[model samples]
Target: MTAYTATVTVRLKRGVLDPEAETTKRALSRLGFELEGLRSTDRYEVDLDAESADAAAARAEEMAERLLANPTIHDYEVSVEER
Candidate 1:
Protein backbone atom coordinates (compact mmCIF):
# COMPACT_ATOMS: atom_id res chain seq x y z
CA MET A 1 0.00 0.00 0.00
CA THR A 2 1.12 3.54 -0.71
CA ALA A 3 0.49 6.56 1.50
CA TYR A 4 -1.97 9.07 0.11
CA THR A 5 -3.96 12.11 1.05
CA ALA A 6 -7.50 12.66 -0.07
CA THR A 7 -9.20 16.02 -0.08
CA VAL A 8 -12.96 16.29 -0.06
CA THR A 9 -14.70 19.58 -0.60
CA VAL A 10 -18.40 19.88 0.20
CA ARG A 11 -20.59 22.76 -0.83
CA LEU A 12 -24.28 23.52 -0.94
CA LYS A 13 -26.11 22.86 -4.17
CA ARG A 14 -27.47 25.65 -6.32
CA GLY A 15 -30.78 27.03 -4.96
CA VAL A 16 -29.99 25.71 -1.53
CA LEU A 17 -30.08 28.00 1.48
CA ASP A 18 -26.67 28.73 3.04
CA PRO A 19 -26.95 31.03 6.01
CA GLU A 20 -23.26 30.90 6.77
CA ALA A 21 -22.29 32.00 3.30
CA GLU A 22 -24.89 34.73 3.38
CA THR A 23 -23.52 36.06 6.62
CA THR A 24 -19.98 35.98 5.28
CA LYS A 25 -21.06 37.76 2.12
CA ARG A 26 -22.67 40.49 4.12
CA ALA A 27 -19.54 40.85 6.18
CA LEU A 28 -17.40 41.05 3.05
CA SER A 29 -19.69 43.72 1.60
CA ARG A 30 -19.27 45.74 4.78
CA LEU A 31 -15.53 45.42 4.27
CA GLY A 32 -15.95 46.83 0.73
CA PHE A 33 -15.49 43.60 -1.20
CA GLU A 34 -17.65 43.51 -4.31
CA LEU A 35 -19.03 40.25 -5.54
CA GLU A 36 -22.10 39.11 -7.36
CA GLY A 37 -22.45 36.03 -5.17
CA LEU A 38 -20.72 33.90 -2.58
CA ARG A 39 -20.77 30.35 -1.30
CA SER A 40 -19.23 28.48 1.59
CA THR A 41 -17.65 25.06 1.56
CA ASP A 42 -16.28 22.48 3.94
CA ARG A 43 -13.01 20.71 3.22
CA TYR A 44 -11.80 17.48 4.76
CA GLU A 45 -8.40 15.89 4.29
CA VAL A 46 -7.87 12.22 4.98
CA ASP A 47 -4.58 10.42 5.13
CA LEU A 48 -4.64 6.74 4.38
CA ASP A 49 -2.90 3.88 2.65
CA ALA A 50 -4.21 2.67 -0.70
CA GLU A 51 -2.97 0.64 -3.58
CA SER A 52 -3.23 3.53 -6.02
CA ALA A 53 -4.44 7.11 -6.40
CA ASP A 54 -7.66 5.87 -7.93
CA ALA A 55 -8.35 3.76 -4.89
CA ALA A 56 -7.68 6.67 -2.57
CA ALA A 57 -10.03 8.90 -4.54
CA ALA A 58 -12.72 6.25 -4.53
CA ARG A 59 -12.51 5.90 -0.79
CA ALA A 60 -12.70 9.62 -0.32
CA GLU A 61 -15.65 9.92 -2.62
CA GLU A 62 -17.42 7.27 -0.62
CA MET A 63 -16.65 9.12 2.56
CA ALA A 64 -18.14 12.28 1.11
CA GLU A 65 -21.25 10.52 -0.11
CA ARG A 66 -21.78 8.68 3.13
CA LEU A 67 -20.95 11.26 5.79
CA LEU A 68 -19.06 14.41 4.82
CA ALA A 69 -21.84 15.78 2.67
CA ASN A 70 -25.61 15.67 2.46
CA PRO A 71 -26.52 14.25 -0.93
CA THR A 72 -29.87 16.00 -1.02
CA ILE A 73 -28.46 19.47 -0.50
CA HIS A 74 -24.75 19.37 -1.16
CA ASP A 75 -22.26 18.50 -3.85
CA TYR A 76 -18.78 17.21 -3.19
CA GLU A 77 -15.52 16.64 -5.06
CA VAL A 78 -12.73 14.30 -4.11
CA SER A 79 -9.05 14.57 -5.01
CA VAL A 80 -6.14 12.39 -4.06
CA GLU A 81 -2.37 12.86 -4.07
CA GLU A 82 0.65 10.90 -3.04
CA ARG A 83 1.86 11.48 0.47
Candidate 2:
Protein backbone atom coordinates (compact mmCIF):
# COMPACT_ATOMS: atom_id res chain seq x y z
CA MET A 1 0.00 0.00 0.00
CA THR A 2 1.14 3.53 -0.71
CA ALA A 3 1.05 6.24 1.93
CA TYR A 4 -1.56 8.82 1.12
CA THR A 5 -2.82 12.11 2.50
CA ALA A 6 -6.49 12.85 2.45
CA THR A 7 -7.81 16.37 2.76
CA VAL A 8 -11.40 16.83 3.78
CA THR A 9 -13.08 20.20 3.74
CA VAL A 10 -16.39 20.81 5.51
CA ARG A 11 -18.54 23.89 5.20
CA LEU A 12 -22.08 24.99 5.87
CA LYS A 13 -24.68 24.77 3.12
CA ARG A 14 -25.69 27.87 1.22
CA GLY A 15 -28.82 28.58 3.25
CA VAL A 16 -27.46 27.39 6.57
CA LEU A 17 -26.60 29.63 9.51
CA ASP A 18 -22.90 30.04 10.30
CA PRO A 19 -22.52 32.06 13.44
CA GLU A 20 -18.76 31.76 13.63
CA ALA A 21 -18.21 33.02 10.11
CA GLU A 22 -20.71 35.77 10.60
CA THR A 23 -18.92 36.90 13.74
CA THR A 24 -15.62 36.84 11.95
CA LYS A 25 -17.01 38.84 9.08
CA ARG A 26 -18.40 41.44 11.46
CA ALA A 27 -15.04 41.71 13.17
CA LEU A 28 -13.28 42.15 9.88
CA SER A 29 -15.71 44.84 8.83
CA ARG A 30 -15.10 46.66 12.09
CA LEU A 31 -11.40 46.54 11.29
CA GLY A 32 -12.14 48.34 7.98
CA PHE A 33 -11.95 45.32 5.69
CA GLU A 34 -14.35 45.52 2.80
CA LEU A 35 -16.09 42.27 1.92
CA GLU A 36 -19.30 41.30 0.20
CA GLY A 37 -19.53 37.99 2.09
CA LEU A 38 -17.52 35.55 4.13
CA ARG A 39 -17.64 31.90 5.08
CA SER A 40 -15.70 29.42 7.18
CA THR A 41 -14.71 25.81 6.70
CA ASP A 42 -13.08 22.96 8.57
CA ARG A 43 -10.17 21.15 6.98
CA TYR A 44 -8.92 17.74 8.02
CA GLU A 45 -5.76 16.08 6.80
CA VAL A 46 -5.58 12.33 7.27
CA ASP A 47 -2.65 10.04 6.62
CA LEU A 48 -3.26 6.43 5.73
CA ASP A 49 -2.22 3.62 3.46
CA ALA A 50 -4.15 3.08 0.27
CA GLU A 51 -3.66 1.40 -3.07
CA SER A 52 -4.17 4.60 -5.01
CA ALA A 53 -5.21 8.22 -4.71
CA ASP A 54 -8.72 7.28 -5.76
CA ALA A 55 -8.99 4.90 -2.83
CA ALA A 56 -7.69 7.53 -0.48
CA ALA A 57 -10.21 10.04 -1.73
CA ALA A 58 -13.02 7.51 -1.40
CA ARG A 59 -12.09 6.78 2.17
CA ALA A 60 -11.93 10.45 2.96
CA GLU A 61 -15.32 11.00 1.37
CA GLU A 62 -16.79 8.30 3.55
CA MET A 63 -15.18 9.84 6.61
CA ALA A 64 -16.65 13.18 5.71
CA GLU A 65 -20.11 11.75 5.20
CA ARG A 66 -20.02 9.81 8.42
CA LEU A 67 -18.49 12.42 10.75
CA LEU A 68 -16.85 15.45 9.22
CA ALA A 69 -20.04 17.00 7.89
CA ASN A 70 -23.73 17.16 8.70
CA PRO A 71 -25.67 16.26 5.61
CA THR A 72 -28.67 18.31 6.64
CA ILE A 73 -26.72 21.53 6.99
CA HIS A 74 -23.23 21.11 5.64
CA ASP A 75 -21.35 20.05 2.50
CA TYR A 76 -17.93 18.51 2.17
CA GLU A 77 -15.24 17.82 -0.42
CA VAL A 78 -12.40 15.34 -0.38
CA SER A 79 -9.01 15.32 -2.07
CA VAL A 80 -6.07 12.96 -1.91
CA GLU A 81 -2.37 13.06 -2.65
CA GLU A 82 0.52 10.64 -2.45
CA ARG A 83 2.57 11.04 0.68
Candidate 3:
Protein backbone atom coordinates (compact mmCIF):
# COMPACT_ATOMS: atom_id res chain seq x y z
CA MET A 1 0.00 0.00 0.00
CA THR A 2 1.04 3.58 -0.67
CA ALA A 3 0.64 6.50 1.69
CA TYR A 4 -1.29 9.50 0.40
CA THR A 5 -2.40 12.93 1.49
CA ALA A 6 -6.03 13.77 0.99
CA THR A 7 -7.17 17.34 0.54
CA VAL A 8 -10.87 17.70 1.13
CA THR A 9 -12.88 20.82 0.39
CA VAL A 10 -16.42 21.32 1.57
CA ARG A 11 -18.82 24.10 0.68
CA LEU A 12 -22.45 24.92 0.93
CA LYS A 13 -24.52 24.19 -2.14
CA ARG A 14 -25.52 27.08 -4.32
CA GLY A 15 -28.68 28.78 -3.04
CA VAL A 16 -28.30 27.09 0.30
CA LEU A 17 -28.23 29.13 3.50
CA ASP A 18 -24.93 28.63 5.29
CA PRO A 19 -25.37 30.27 8.64
CA GLU A 20 -21.85 29.58 9.72
CA ALA A 21 -20.38 30.94 6.54
CA GLU A 22 -22.66 33.93 6.63
CA THR A 23 -21.67 34.67 10.21
CA THR A 24 -18.01 34.55 9.32
CA LYS A 25 -18.56 36.79 6.34
CA ARG A 26 -20.32 39.30 8.50
CA ALA A 27 -17.57 39.16 11.06
CA LEU A 28 -14.96 39.78 8.38
CA SER A 29 -16.95 42.65 7.04
CA ARG A 30 -17.24 44.11 10.51
CA LEU A 31 -13.49 43.86 10.88
CA GLY A 32 -13.12 46.20 7.86
CA PHE A 33 -12.63 43.43 5.32
CA GLU A 34 -14.72 44.10 2.27
CA LEU A 35 -16.24 40.69 1.79
CA GLU A 36 -19.48 41.64 0.12
CA GLY A 37 -19.26 38.85 -2.41
CA LEU A 38 -17.15 36.52 -0.36
CA ARG A 39 -18.04 32.89 0.10
CA SER A 40 -16.87 30.57 2.84
CA THR A 41 -15.42 27.07 2.63
CA ASP A 42 -13.80 24.42 4.77
CA ARG A 43 -10.76 22.30 4.04
CA TYR A 44 -9.19 19.28 5.69
CA GLU A 45 -5.96 17.45 5.15
CA VAL A 46 -5.97 13.72 5.81
CA ASP A 47 -3.35 11.02 5.52
CA LEU A 48 -4.41 7.65 4.17
CA ASP A 49 -2.99 4.48 2.70
CA ALA A 50 -4.21 2.57 -0.31
CA GLU A 51 -3.05 0.43 -3.21
CA SER A 52 -2.94 3.31 -5.71
CA ALA A 53 -3.58 7.01 -6.10
CA ASP A 54 -6.91 6.25 -7.73
CA ALA A 55 -7.89 4.08 -4.85
CA ALA A 56 -6.85 6.73 -2.37
CA ALA A 57 -8.86 9.36 -4.18
CA ALA A 58 -11.89 7.06 -4.28
CA ARG A 59 -11.61 6.44 -0.60
CA ALA A 60 -11.40 10.14 0.15
CA GLU A 61 -14.43 10.76 -2.01
CA GLU A 62 -16.37 8.11 -0.21
CA MET A 63 -15.31 9.47 3.18
CA ALA A 64 -16.49 12.95 2.23
CA GLU A 65 -19.77 11.79 0.77
CA ARG A 66 -20.54 9.54 3.68
CA LEU A 67 -19.27 11.58 6.60
CA LEU A 68 -17.83 15.00 5.85
CA ALA A 69 -20.35 16.46 3.45
CA ASN A 70 -24.10 16.63 3.44
CA PRO A 71 -25.03 15.52 -0.08
CA THR A 72 -28.43 17.16 0.04
CA ILE A 73 -27.07 20.55 1.16
CA HIS A 74 -23.36 20.77 0.45
CA ASP A 75 -20.79 20.25 -2.26
CA TYR A 76 -17.57 18.37 -1.71
CA GLU A 77 -14.38 17.70 -3.69
CA VAL A 78 -11.37 15.60 -2.79
CA SER A 79 -7.88 15.15 -4.17
CA VAL A 80 -5.27 12.63 -3.13
CA GLU A 81 -1.53 12.82 -3.57
CA GLU A 82 0.51 9.64 -3.30
CA ARG A 83 3.53 9.71 -1.14
Q: How many collisions per candidate? A: 0, 0, 0
- lDDT, residue 81, model 3: 83
Q: Which pairs of residues clash in candidate 3, taking residues 3 or more apart in a chain or in different chains?
A: none
lDDT of 3 by residue, 13-78 (tens): 899987777788888888999755767888988899899988888888998988998899889989
| Best first by TM-score, ranked | 2, 1, 3
* Candidate lDDT (C-alpha), each: 0.93, 0.92, 0.87
Q: What residue runs in model 2 are displaced by over 4 Å at the alpha carbon?
A: none
Cα lDDT tens digits for candidate 1, 1-83: 99999999999999999998899999999999998898789999999999999999999998998899999999999989999
| Model 1: lowest-lDDT 10 consecutive positions | 34-43
TM-score of each: 0.92, 0.93, 0.86
Model 1: CA > 4 A from native? none
Model 2 lDDT at residue 36: 95
- Tell me, by TM-score, which candidate is best: 2
Task: State the RMSD for candidate 1.
Answer: 1.0
